[model samples]
Target: MPVRLPGPAVTEELDRVLGDRAAPGYADLRRLPYLEMVLKESLRLYPPGPYGARETAEPLAVGEYRIPAGTVVFYPFRAIQLNPDHWPEPERFRPERFTPEQVAGRARLAWVPFGLGPRSCEGAGPAMVECRLLLAVLLKRFRFRPVPGHRVDATERFVRWAADDIRMVVTPRKAGPPPRS
Candidate 1:
């Protein structure tokens, strides 16, 4: 089956965050929690799509309105992600918020970056593995620092992204030798 690729813009930003860490396999990628946190932050803010809609099979009451049977129900993913009720300190960049324990305790329907239900994004697993591998390899070989004139300003484009693009400098690591000039 053909795979759905992550958006180019998203991929590029991920590259910036991953730097020299791209790896050859899942095992290598599994050790980067920080990478995972970055991706989670992206999803929470921009999600692949702005909102998700579904048809209700039966009538239900949501807040003050009675949602009739067969009505289309819209779930605003980004809005919910930013909702202070479900996420405290929502505007901050926090990787720990997605640690296994913290994520598990959150409301089941919250943080639907990949959507929810059976039809959610099928590529979630592969994408995550790819990201992890990249982070692992990069962290092991280089150090990243933001470029002098660059700063990340996040915006939305079917997904949350750096509004001004993420620009950084990658410096190779010297493990056990001193440079002789």
Candidate 2:
């Protein structure tokens, strides 16, 4: 997915924001708003855990129908994230959708990449930090370009995965030394 996007533009943004900082501390990571947006949009489109199930503790009314207790309800993350009512051009990968203004305007649960409520993944925070740091450092060192003719599709299972191996050519980046202090 990274390879499919405008790699140079993203890399430029990372360089502009991070410079020669090999390690992005928590504070630094917080400042990389576009990077956060990219990650959020990616997670929204392809959540690792596509569906979550919860057994109702008590009878509930949804819309016009009543759901009995003990009914196993499935929350389809992909479907909800892709719903056109909430996301225009849902299939397109546009990280700007996660801008502060846009996010503030949306429903709180409009995007639930890490699930929601008490059952949400405990590792969500750490995982996001790890991903952002790794991506930042890696993008600083290398450029990933998709191999032509390689087909990448999201497959549904217990978790979402690439239907086939994603092929990308990684090229080492060549840039001048970081600006001196």
Candidate 3:
């Protein structure tokens, strides 16, 4: 199922980044480094989907083995993210891994949050902006914390989802007192 809403951490991160830069249509969301980091890390750890496939068109040598053309290949994003050769301390959630200079210097196709090549997600940019905006609005109004008896579990299907549903306590922020008229 679709998330339908942003998680609490995402919301908090956005607020921390935006601070006072509250503008409409994602103006405030892009200014946050930590928020971007969290997003990148989250995507790395748990991409929207489980895997992807491609058909090989020509004979190729993969790690000393020559496979004939026309073979179907599967790309497991989860495994790639956890590969020690590609990421250090793969299990840890570190957004700094996606720093501009760091990412630019990394191998191509290393981070495929929205897929790669010519068939990547067409809505990647807009979707990211939307996620940021949603998180910003939510963080400005409330805080989320895990409920006493519940934990978040995620499942991967066509798109990864919160397996047991995101059970959290949404405490609305107390508004400041108004000026005396």
Candidate 4:
């Protein structure tokens, strides 16, 4: 986050929400909406599972196309998330796209980083909470910047990840507001 426009703003939010707390706790996670937005935007760009497949239970119609029942349908999550129709400036890192008002305005399946429906990932809930909490604690304690000339690319595979891994420099942050009495 330190390399993106929202980085400093996120740090500010963390400082404000976790005031004198040293680190964030479970209850405090709900109070940090901006961090959640950032995580959503990140997931939209780099979904770990790039695609999903499901069998249609019933014949379906989309637009002028028709699909017979039992046909296997593939949902390309990365492509869908990057589609300009659902997400404006799809390649940009704009967390505002996930704001309550914005999310409510978009299609339900427009952002499915963890897949969806009955067979969707069972760990999605815990995963998101884990990410949010980890981000909060880390952002509060350190600043991260990509190492110079290190390009992180997500390869298409069973699960997507940077081939060489994303390299970054993490610097410890100075103490924030002193513990409140």
Candidate 5:
């Protein structure tokens, strides 16, 4: 999605933080705030794990009706994340919506790319770090352009999958000396 919706601001920020370096260190990754926002916004639009289920431990009241104990409750994360109520321009890819102030203004549970609560995925933190590091490295190393006539759609299974093959052309970046501090 980042490739499809390239933001000049994000690119400029990446270049500023990365300088002429081909790879980003931990500190460098931290400095790319816009890139982080882009990644999070991407996740918000298309979370890898789109749905989760939990069995009710006890009788629960939901609005007017009561759900009996042991009822399997499904959490449709994708739908929740895309709800227009929580996010303005829900379908549009806008990373600026994730600025610290904007995030703090929204409901605490509005963004749950990795699920929520104590039962949330244990690897969430590490997975985010890994994704940021790998994406930063790739963005630094190449420019991605979508291939003409390729179709990309979202499909749900155990995890969200692209419905069709996503074809992109990756052009290796020219090597240059790191920018002077």
Candidate 6:
């Protein structure tokens, strides 16, 4: 995230919301809507898993075709999030796209990094909360900058990952007490 303009803003937001506290409670996290946006945008760019499948309970119809019931449908999480029709600039990482107003204007299924429907991940809710908290705490305590000349390629497997591996430089922040474990 340090590679982009919004990345610094994200750290700024976390710092503002956290103030001088090394550890924030749930109440403090509640004020971090932009943090959530960053997470959402990150997920949109690289979801946990590459793809998910669901069996149709009833027949479904596409624009000009009908899918019979019981047919398993496969959907790529990244593809859905990157669709030009739904996302303005499919390749860019703009957390502003995840603003409440912008989200309300998109389709219900536009953002589903955790998968969707009844078969979706059960830990999705808790995972999101945990991620936000962890990110807030860590980013508040450190400045993460990408390693120079490191090229990251997305591996299209069960879970999304950098084929060359993600490398970064982490510098500890000198403000306030160390972040709570």
Whole-model lDDT per candidate: 0.64, 0.81, 0.68, 0.85, 0.80, 0.82
Best by TM-score: 4
Q: Between candidates 2 and 4, which one is better according to TM-score?
A: 4
TM-scores, one per candidate? 0.67, 0.88, 0.77, 0.89, 0.89, 0.88
Across 91-137, the per-residue lDDT of candidate 5 in tens digits comes to 88888888999999899988988888888889988888888888878
How far out, in Å, is residue 33 in model 4?
0.4
Winner on lDDT between 1 and 3 is 3
Q: lDDT-based ranking, best first?
A: 4, 6, 2, 5, 3, 1
Clashes of each: 7, 0, 0, 0, 0, 0
lDDT score for residue 111 of model 1: 85
Clashing pairs in 3: none
Writing each residue's lDDT as its tens digit, candidate 1 over 83-142 gives 888789887656567888988888977888777888788998877677566655665466
Q: Which stretches of candidate 6 lie over 4 Å from their true place?
A: 1-6, 175-181
For 1-181, candidate 4 gives per-residue lDDT tens digits of 2234356778877888888666899998888899999999989988988799999999999899999999999989989999999999988899989999999999999999989898899999999999988888888888888898877766788888777888888899864663344
Give the better candidate number (4 or 6) by TM-score: 4
Q: With candidate 1 superimposed using the best TM-score fit, by how many Å does residue 23's alpha carbon deviate from the native?
A: 3.3
| Worst 10 contiguous positions by lDDT, candidate 4 | 1-10
Which pairs clash in model 1? 20-138, 21-134, 21-137, 21-138, 22-134, 46-160, 153-163
Candidate 2: regions farther than 4 A off:
1-3, 176-181
TM-score of 4: 0.89
lDDT tens per residue, model 3, 1-181 = 2222334455555445544444334555556655666667778887887787777899878998887899888788788777777788887776778888878877877778777777778998888777656655666677676667676677777888787888777888643332243
What alpha-carbon RMSD in Å does predicted model 1 have with respect to the real structure? 8.7
Could you give candidate 2's per-residue lDDT for residues 10-110 as a string of tens digits?
56666666777665677788767787888888888888888887889999999999999999999999888999888999988889899989999888888
Task: Work out candidate 5's RMSD over C-alphas.
Answer: 2.5
lDDT score, candidate 4, position 45:
83
